[model samples]
Target: MYESCFYFVINMSISGSLVILSLLIVRQIKIISRRLLYVLWFVALIRMLLPFAISSSISVFNYLSGLIKKLIPVGNLFDANFTVSNYFNAALSYSPMEYKTQRFEHVFGISSCIWLMGVCISLIAIIVIYCSTIRQYKNAVHLKDNIYEDKTVLSPFLLGIRNPKIILPIGLDISSSQAVHIIAHEKTHMQRMDNLWRIIGLGTVCIHWFNPIAWFGFFFFLNDMELSCDEATTKTYGFAKKKEYAEALFSIAGNRQNKNLIHASFGKSDTKSRVLNVLAYKRLSVFGIAASIAFLLLVAIMLLTNPKV
Candidate 1:
C-alpha cells in the first residue's frame, strides 16, 4: 500500500510540474487570448484527474523520461517488490544511518500517512473557510433570485456550490456605465460555469496538497479565468466599451482581501493583467478565431495525454 501511494504521488507531482512549465511557456506568447489559456488550464485539470492517459510516441514526457533514464539509470525504482534491503543498499552510497533502527516499510507507511493527513487538513480548512464566509454574509439582504447585498463584503462575489448567487457590497455605488460592465462580467462567469470550475480547482488542490506546482497552477488558472471572463464581457458589450470596462475594474479595486478560494468573484486577482488585456481587447478576425481554436486543440492533446513507452 505504501509503495502504491508513493508512486501515485510521484506521478501526480510529475504531471503537475509539467503543467506549470507549460503555463510558463504559454505566458510568454502574447498573441494567445486568455480564453484559450483558460481552456488549456481546464485540460491541465483533466490531466491531473485521470491517472491513465492515452500514450503516443510524440508525447513530451516520453522524450524527457528517456533523457533522464540515460543520465540516471533508475530502472529498478518501481519494482513490484520494493524491499527494505534495496533501500538500505541505496542509502549506503549516501549517509547510512543505523540499519536496525530504521525500516523501509515503516518510513514509507508514515510518509503515505502524512500525505493523506495533509489532504484531510486541506479539506477541513476549506470547509472552515466556507462556513466562516457564509456566517459573515448572514446579515446580507436578498436583492433578487440568487443575488445578495452585503455591507461587509468589500467587492462583489458569488458564493455557494449549488445555485450559487451573485453578491454585491452595499456601499458600492458606481456610475451606471460601470455597473453595466461589472454586471455583465459576473453574468458571463455564470454563463461559462466558472463558479463550478472554481470549486473543481479547489478540490483538485486539496487532492494534490503536497505539490507546490499544483497550488501555483491553481492561482494562475484563476487569473486566466478572470481574464477570459473579461474578454467575454468585452465581446458582449462590443470593443467600443473597453475604456469603460477598464475604468470599472479600477473603481472596484477597493478590496485586496483574500477571498474564499472556492468562491468566484468579480474581484481583482490580477488588476494589471486585467486592465492591460482590457485596453488591448480586439475582436479576432474569422480566420484568426479558427486558427486560435485549432492551436488550442492541438495544445490540449499534447498536454493532456501520456507518452507511449
Candidate 2:
C-alpha cells in the first residue's frame, strides 16, 4: 500500500507533464475544432486521476519509460518500491536520516506522509476559498427568476453546485440581445455540467499540488472549457453574433476582478484569445470532424494506455 501510493503520485506527475506538452503542441494547430480540444483536456484530467491503465503494444508510456531507464541509471524505474526519495538518494549519494530511518521501506512511508500532507493543505485551502466566496454573495439581491444582481462581482457567473444560481453584476448596461447572449452562455455551462468538471479539476490540483505542469494544465483546461462554451453559444445563437459575443467578453473582462474562485464566470482570464477563437470559429467540415474524432481517439489511446513490456 505504501509503494502503491508513491507510484501513483509519480505516474500522475509524469502523465500530467506529458498532457501539458501534448496540449502545447495541439494548440498550435489552427484547423482543429476548439470543442475537440475541450474533450481532449477532460480526458487529460481523467488520465491524471487514474493509477491503472490499459496496456497496448504501441503505447507511448512503454517507449518513453524504456528510453528513460536507458538514459538514466535510476534504481529500478519500474520497481513497485521505487520512490522520489530513493531516486534522489541514489543520484546524489546522500540520504536525510529523518526520512531514511533504519528500515529501507520507512523511506517510502515517510515520503508518502509528506505527499499526503501537501494534499491535505491544498484541499483545505480550496474549501476555505469556496466557503469565503459563498459568504460574500450571501446578501445578493434577487433579480428575475433564478438570477441575482450582486455588487460584489464584476462579470456574470453561475454559483452553487446542486441548485446553481446565476449571479450578474448589478450595473451592466446590457441590451436585450446582449443579455440573451450572456444568459445563454452561462446556461450552456450549467447544461454541460462544467462546474462538476471544475470541481474534479480542483481535486486533481489538490492531489498533485507539487507539479507545476499540473497547475498550468488545469488552467489551460479551464480556458478550453470556456471556449467550448462559447462555441456552443454561437451554435445556438448563430455565428453572426460572434462579434457581439466577443465584444461582450471584452466589456465584461474590463470589470472582472480576481476575487472569486468557485463560480464559473462568463468572462475568462484569457479573454483576448477566447475572443479571437470566437472570431476564428468555423464550421467543421465532414472530413475535419472525422479527423478530429480520430485524433482524439489516438491521443486517448496514447496517453491513457500503457504498453505491456
Candidate 3:
C-alpha cells in the first residue's frame, strides 16, 4: 500500500508539471479559439487521473527527469532490493537494527497514511457541498420543458448531470432578447456536456488537493469552459446581437451568486474576459482554422506523453 501511495504522489507531481506547461502555452497563444483551450485543459485533467501513458523522448518530462537524476542519488533513495511488505514484516519482528536500517520505509508508511487521510477529507467536503447546493434548489418551479424558475437563484444556470434542467431566476423576462441569449448560453453548456467535464475536473483537484497547481488548473479549466461556451453561444450573432449578448452577460454577472462546481452558471466565471471575448469575436478563415487544428495537435503530442524511462 505504501508503494502504491508513493507512486500516486509521483504521478500527481508529473501531472502538475504538465498543468504548468499547459497554462504557459495557453497564455502565449491567448488569441486562439477558446474551444481549443478547453480541449487542452481537458487533456491536462486526463493526465492527472491516469498514471501511465506512452513514453516519448520528446516529452518535456524526459529532460526534467535527467536533471533530477543528476541532482539526486536516485539509486540510494529507492533501493531495488527493498520492498514495502518485507519492510513491514521485518518491523513486526522487532529487530532494532533492521528497523534502524529501514527508516526510509517507515517514513514512507507514515506519509501514505497522511495522504489517505487527506483524500478522505477532500471527498467528504465535495459530497457535502454538492448535497447542500442541491437541497437549496429542490423547490424550483418547473415552467416548461426542462426549464424551471426559482426565486432563490440569483442567476440562470443548468443543474443536474443525467437529467439537467435550466433554472432561471423568477423575474427574468423569458420573451426578451437578453433572456433568449441567456437561455441559449445554458443550452450550449448542455449540448457540450460541460457539467460532466466539470465533475471530472473537480475530481482531479480533490485527488490532488496537496498540489496547488492542480487547483489552478481546475479554475483555469472552468474559465476556458465558460469562454468556449460563450463563443459557441454567440457564434452566429451579428454585431448588434453580439453587443446585446455582452449586455446579457453583464446583467447576469451583476446577479451572480456563489459558484457551484456542479452547476454550469451563465456569467459565473471570468465575466470581464468573457465579455471581451464576445465583443472581439471574429469568424476564423479557412487557413486560420487549419492553423488552429495544427496547433492543437502539436500541444497534444507535446503534453500528453510520458517521459521515456
Candidate 3, 1-309: lDDT as tens digits? 756765556555555556566565675676888887888886787677754455566765555533332111134445432211111232334555765657867777787778778878988887787778777888999887888999988989998777888999998888899889999999999999998888777877877777788887788788888999999988888989999999999888888898788779997987888899988988888998899899887777667665554
lDDT of 2 by residue, 1-309 (tens): 755676567666776677677786887788776788888887678767765455566656666643342112225545542222111232233445655455766777787888888988988888888777777888899877777878877789988777777888887544566677788899988888888788888888778887888888888888788888888778644556888888888888887777455668898568888888788887777987888889999977776665553
Better of 2 and 3 by TM-score: 3
The C-alpha stretches of model 3 lying farther than 4 A from their native spots are: 63-101
User: Which lDDT tens digits does candidate 1 get at residues 1-309?
Assistant: 755655455565667578677876997799989988888888778766654555555555655643232111224554332211111122334544657446865776787788888878988887788788777777788876676778777778777766767778785553478766777788888888887898788888788887888888899999998999988888755556788888878878876556667777776677888989977877899999999999987777677656544
Q: TM-score for all predictions? A: 0.84, 0.83, 0.85
Model 1 deviation from native, Cα RMSD in Å: 5.7
How does model 3 score by TM-score? 0.85
Local distance difference test, per candidate?
0.72, 0.73, 0.76
Identify the leading candidate in terms of lDDT.
Answer: 3
Q: Model 3, residue 247: what's the lDDT?
A: 92
Task: Provide the clashing-pair count of each candidate structure.
Answer: 0, 0, 0
